[model samples]
Target: MDWPTAAVVIVIAVCISLLIIAALAVVVGGKAAKGLKEFDKPTTRHTF
Candidate 1:
């Protein structure tokens, strides 16, 4: 394979990895939010 082909493969691999990570983050975050909701209250102002 040439340099360009190698670069394209690397880029595609990175994109796929990022997508998988994002998906896992969403799943874990939803579970965490549900678990924490019972201990927290909503505020009129953004506190983050």
Candidate 2:
């Protein structure tokens, strides 16, 4: 593809990947917090 088309494709790919990553992070964040809470029952302020 041409430079402009390639640039657009790259940008789209990066955006899509970032969105997927964000979604995954959102999904995992809850579980991670729960795990941290269990791991450190005394104080969750620092880790959570």
Candidate 3:
């Protein structure tokens, strides 16, 4: 591929990777929050 085309493809790939990572982080964080709630007595879980 040409230089400009290659650069565009790389950027698109990076953006998609970032988005997937962000989604996974959200899922994991929510699970962690729920786990932490178990340690706290009497408070609402308030999970996602």
Candidate 4:
């Protein structure tokens, strides 16, 4: 294979990997945010 062809293949592989990682990050982040929201209730404070 030519250098250009190899380079293009590598670039495509890198892009696809990046896209998969980004998608997983979004999914995990959304779940984490939802969990955090569940704990966002106001807490009572006592003054001494």
Best candidate per TM-score, number? 3
Evaluate residue 44 in candidate 2 and report its C-alpha lDDT on the 0 to 100 scale. 59
In the range 1-48, model 1's lDDT, one tens digit per residue, is: 999999999999999999999999999999999767844656523464
The top-ranked prediction according to lDDT is: 2
Residues 2-48 of candidate 4 have per-residue lDDT tens digits of 99999999999999999999999999999999877766645422221
Which parts of model 4 have CA positions greater than 4 angstroms off?
42-48
What is the TM-score of each predicted model, taking all chains together? 0.74, 0.66, 0.80, 0.78
Q: Lowest-scoring 10 consecutive residues by lDDT in candidate 2?
A: 39-48
Query: Candidate 2 clashing pairs?
Result: none
Cα RMSD for candidate 3? 5.9
Tens digits of lDDT, candidate 2, 1-48: 899999999999999999999999998998999887787875655565
Q: Which of 3 and 4 is the better model by TM-score?
A: 3
Off by over 4 Å in 1: 38-48
Off by over 4 Å in 3: 42-48
lDDT, candidate 3, at 10: 99
lDDT digits (tens) for residues 6-48 of candidate 3: 9999999999999999999999999999888775645554432
Report lDDT (CA) for all predictions: 0.87, 0.89, 0.88, 0.86
Q: Is candidate 1 or candidate 2 better by TM-score?
A: 1
Model 2 residue runs over 4 Å out of place are 36-48
Q: Name every residue pair that clashes in candidate 4.
A: none
